[model samples]
Target chain A: MTSPAPLVVGFVAATVLALTAACLLGSTPMGVERVLAALIGSGDAGDRLVVWEIRFPRALAAFLAGSALGASGAALQGLLRNPLAEPGVLGVSATASLAATFFLYYGFVSVAAWGLPVAAIAGALAATALIAFAAVHTRSIITLILIGIGIASFAGAAMSLLMNLAPHPYALSDMINWMLGSVANRSLDDIALAAPFLLCGLVVLYGTRRGLAALTLGEEAAAGVGLNLPRQRLATVLGAGLSTGASVALAGAIGFVGIVAPHIVRPLVAHDPARSLVPSALLAGLLLVLADIGVRLIQSEQELRLGVVAALVGAPVFVWIAVRRQAARD
Target chain B: MTELIATGLTLRVGRATLVDGVSFCLRPGELVALLGPNGAGKSSLLRASLGLQKRSGGTATLGGRDSERLNPVTRARLVSYLPQIRSIAWPNVVRDVVALGRFSHGAAIGTLREADRAAVERALDACDLLHLANRRCDTLSGGELARLHCARAFAAEAPLLLADEPVGGLDPFHQFRVMDITRAFVGRGGGALVVLHDVALAARYAHRLLWMKDGRIVAHGTPDQTLTAERLAAIYGVRACVDGLRVALEGAA
Candidate 1:
């Protein structure tokens, strides 16, 4: 197998290219020279304003959200000892979506500017805690996944019910748009609001990486090797929850980047969960940024939703992974 | 040298008593084989001794410290355990997997110090897995994985080893090799308490045999005293002829 240095460098290169593309290709297309000049602070005021204020923050939001999802997914998969375990598929993101939507629809955001994001983060934490609690009681991976699916379905239904009773058509559209997910109209303030939580989550995960590595030996053996199992589980849950919550707040519950990016990078790190964390975060961030670029390039009457495009690309990959996992088991 | 002492250890699951009052001492430089039929609580006893299970009664001590009160890392440094189920969650390389034994010593993945690296290498060499050091654990056969976990325990350099069904999936050669590894460990003044169903192998390698029935110790002594014809019939319900440490089964009792 190849060393991690080249792989990390490759991911960085791809990300730079994608970020450049994200800047250059948009509703108002800018030339390479103009984008370059704008980037270096020598272009027209209008170009500079668009580049620095609008496009950059949106792109950054996409990347940060993707990084959060990717890292959270890797930590979760390591904790559960299942590659298929991810924030979106495990119902955490959906529940966060529901909480954010509830706050928005009920005018909770009017009372406090931080209410929606906090509610989303709390929702994610609650859902993750529920899943972790269930995980302890059951030994079968399939059962745990089914419980996640159940939570997702329930959250989806509740969100639909909220939409059904929405007081106005504009409110309905807003809810629908949020549910589909997009980084459009996102500003630096949104990134600023979510970044601290994301950083905290990543720090926690990084500190607990060794415990995740030990968990590969199975829970009991991990405990036997002197790992405090409860502490490990709590750290993983807190880390994954904070990151997932922040991502949902920033980007509205995009799915599958977590699963796909980690799955792709696992072999590069010799399948060690600890080593896979950073690379997975980088790759997933790149993938989401590229997907956002795709969303911009394809001209639709209304701009395409980033999450819809992501699901279109990622759901099939999810199926492929599940099938391969089953085949491996058989 | 450290010793493990258990007194009146009892484990009950709700209405059912899984492990009745059982007591024994595993001293350094001794290889003790715990023998029992199916569902006789051999696994439970091993877990209880390590404080991995919640015992309903009595106490277990390691080096004069209460087993339940010992810090996890301190307990791990005193004793290493190889469980019955050997499942590796990821496809980590054999060397990386074995190095996990140094977890109590603060060795992180991909960051092994000199002593940790030496211990891992020595364990691999001891288990004859040095040649397969880079292979992914998931690709290993059952016996190989079993031996790999044993090597992990050996890498810990703990004073006492508690292994459940360590030799079960192994072929004759590997089985004897595992027994020899335990014997060598004991010879080095370490202690071992192994759970096994192979009476003959236990009689051959162990300094003492603990015969348990229905979660209680029926007898514990040298092989010569424990492997009698009448005891064999009573414990295993098998009619057999006993000559010294050898038992030749004739039919079912």
Candidate 2:
């Protein structure tokens, strides 16, 4: 019977620990004292440059992106009342990536620095709207997910087309890197660009927490309890779209963090969907920071993609959960 | 005072009219049972009257406000609904499932308030589930799960309760236990509109009976008047012997 207060305290502590480790344990390692000084603007130029300019932004991006994805996943799972539901399951991330790749292929980056994220968000919204429409028409959860998968496949094909027709070798390589997903080399500007959308998405999802909890009883019962189903649906889909879209725009398709984070924290929150959101977000931020740290630590000829590490670690966990769920059903 | 009032309620889904021109008033201190065969619009009428479904034409009011226009919080406070389908998506504890009733009362997100806790405790006690309050809902037996859902509706402590087959799939003892709880709810100055298939139980427990057929209420009165042999044969196509509160179905008409 782990209560929410203690669980939140534990997660916050863990997040702080992970954040500190991420700042201090990079390729050119800095001592704790130097990291602390750099954080407070009292360290020398090179130390500050290493800590503030490089590692800080990347860690912050990972944290923000993970938090957004985790909150979005929790919200989606609650709304759908399906444990397997995640932002990726809804085709949002794929469509956002497709849009970003579209912009990258056409050299839309020259139009404006914010062009890619804006395009990604727009694509995410469009895909979410399509899925929402399909979901409303279909009562079956399986059908809704199948429709989402269809949309994802369509977007995936479009992305492949963009890659095949990439204008130059450099553009192709950049698209490849973006598709692999990384928070490395990201600047504070990238974080700033994605922050507002992420924050807005978090707020939207947070506001729907109560409604999501009600929905666990099913839609009619939720409505009977005075939950506005349409409004809750809009907030959840739009929020997921915005947060996931922004995350994909900033960090490519970082898979499994959204789905994995909530699964880890769900039982700790006593399976209360509304109570699961904040902890899931915090834990997800921690998970992503640690994963990013792992990306740095793994000695390889070429740097491992953060997304690759997440999926490599996460896919097996997902399969294990599915198997366990099947066993339980039996 | 009237807890729920409906007038000329009609529900149509495309070309089908599930509930047509049905009207009823539920008052405090009364437990009304809605009995009908399948496709007789019992569930649809309840859903439409509660504004959970779109009514083609009519008005339903709860606590003197139009149910269609009532805000969610106020509507939740005025009426509690127990749908026929009983499902707990997650393996939430019994207490948490009951606390969902307080969604409109606020504090649905964080820790429960003192009042909310008291209400949940009271509900658990009423349904005789306090001992199993911490048990995971998915692990509960069918009868226990039925009682748990009853407790969820009871937790709302609203003036009116609309339950669709609240005791369906329960054993005999639990069935009577649930009906007794419904009766007790009305005895304590609340109102209830329950849909039941058991004519004998409805006869024994309900204060009145609303017998429906083909999307219309063919009879609305005391148990004696509504469960007549002629009506039983005509509506349900069953030959039945009725003795006081006990009804025995003999054969198909």
Candidate 3:
């Protein structure tokens, strides 16, 4: 039995290393000396502007978004008692993206800086409520996943409709770029806007960890051990909704970091769902920072969307996991 | 003194009465077996008594307090429950599963207190599961999983245990082992209400027998008084012979 403490420490260290790389390795690359000098307020104006203004906020946003998704995914998986469960699969991210896109397409985002996240959170909560209602009627994991897919498809279609109805080509292209999902070009203001909702969601999810752990024995047994099922359910749904919504609001619809990070961390934590949250969040932050760095490294006419890279990397892994699970069952 | 008392307990689901005004008392140092045919409301009675199900009428008290009104922690400390449908959603190890019994005992959020560890150890030993403590629960056989759940309930150390067929899928050796564990729990001044389909095993191990048909208790007394051939025929629709503490089903009446 390996202790989770070292694994968590290792993940945090890896995230720090990735964050440093994300900050230094962008289009105008900075040496380690200049990066360190910029942090200490002694570098040239260009270096400081490039490091602090351009890269620092984007790196932080990517890290925060990834942490939110990872923690939310781990919590959702525990609540649903299904390893395949994730914010993206559950339609939370897609619905959130739809709401944010709606705001952006309608030019409402220009009215209030917080409008996008607020709308996204509302959409996320609505989708989560729908899923929670469906969950009560079905005990089959596959059925729940199918319901999630249906919801995701509906939201995706609505987003496309909004894209088609955009009044101008600029707005249409803006919506398209935002829907593609990226941490690039995000400002500190974006991070500030989404941080509160993400923090609140994380707190709620953390509070439900004990209940989620108890649920591994099934609902009746969990309640028998004094867990308040209704309260736990509410907390889990609300938490996952808020965090996932805020992540999408900050970085569009980055998918699979939530699902992938937890899978990577679960074994390190001895498969204890409750113990998996913090490590998952750290690993998720690392994954997103690395992916964002990958976006900058690949030289193309236009940089690849962070979401596109994540899916390309994550979809194959997801298939491999599903196949492996099927083989194990056989 | 009574560890559990239920009077006129009733459960209804959409106009269907599953348990109708069932009442019983479980005293310390007593092993009571609830016996009945399929759909006789034995499971519902246990669930309702533990406040796991809504009772349309009547009330249940644990240690002289209304069970329904008690806080979850206090209720869990007073009465432990073992449901018939056994499931493990995650691949948790056996010791971790057993330690969940201490959820209300200050084992919060994956960290177990000293007392929690001690209780889990005692329970694992009692159920003869110490050697398999580190094994993943999903890998265990049905019988071993059943014992693991039994061990979990035992770990709670609640005064009253409400078990719905705790020995349902075990082999003969394990069946007797589970009965002995229940007997030992009662021997230590704990009370138990067990639902069983095995009349002979119930007759041998239980201090008292409660026979039900439909949704009510039809007979309640010593095994000798409750396991009569006429009662068996009436309740189970079968003819059975009761010799000493053993019961054998002859045929359907």
Chain A TM-score, prediction 2: 0.95
- TM-score of each model, in listed order: 0.96, 0.96, 0.97
In model 1, which regions exceed 4 Å deviation? A1-3, A40-42
Model 1: per-residue Cα lDDT over A1-330, one tens digit each: 534677889999988888877888666778999998998899899999898788888888899999999999999999999999999999999998999999899998889877777888898999999999999999898998898999899999999999999999998987876688789888988888888888898899888888898889888888888888888999999999888898898999898999999999999898888889988998999988988988888878988899999899999999999999899989
Off by over 4 Å in 2: A27-29
Ranked by lDDT, top first? 1, 3, 2
lDDT per residue, candidate 3, A1-330, as tens digits?
545788888888888888877778877767999998886789799998888888888988989899999999899899888877888888888999998888887779789988889999998888888888788789887899899999999998998899778898988877766677888888888898999999999999988888888888788888888887789899999999999899899998888888899999887776788899888888888898889888888999987999899888887877787788789779
Model 3 docking grade? medium
Residues A120-162 of candidate 2: C-alpha lDDT, one tens digit per residue: 8888888887877877787777887788789888988888888
lDDT scores of the candidates, listed in order: 0.89, 0.86, 0.86
- Give lDDT tens digits, candidate 3, residues B168-188: 878888889889988999998
Candidate 1, CAPRI quality class derived from DockQ: medium
Better-scoring candidate (TM-score), 1 or 3: 3
Clashing pairs in model 1, backbone N/Cα/C closer than 3 A: none
Worst-scoring 10-residue span by lDDT in model 1 chain A:
A1-10
Candidate 2 local accuracy as lDDT? Answer: 0.86
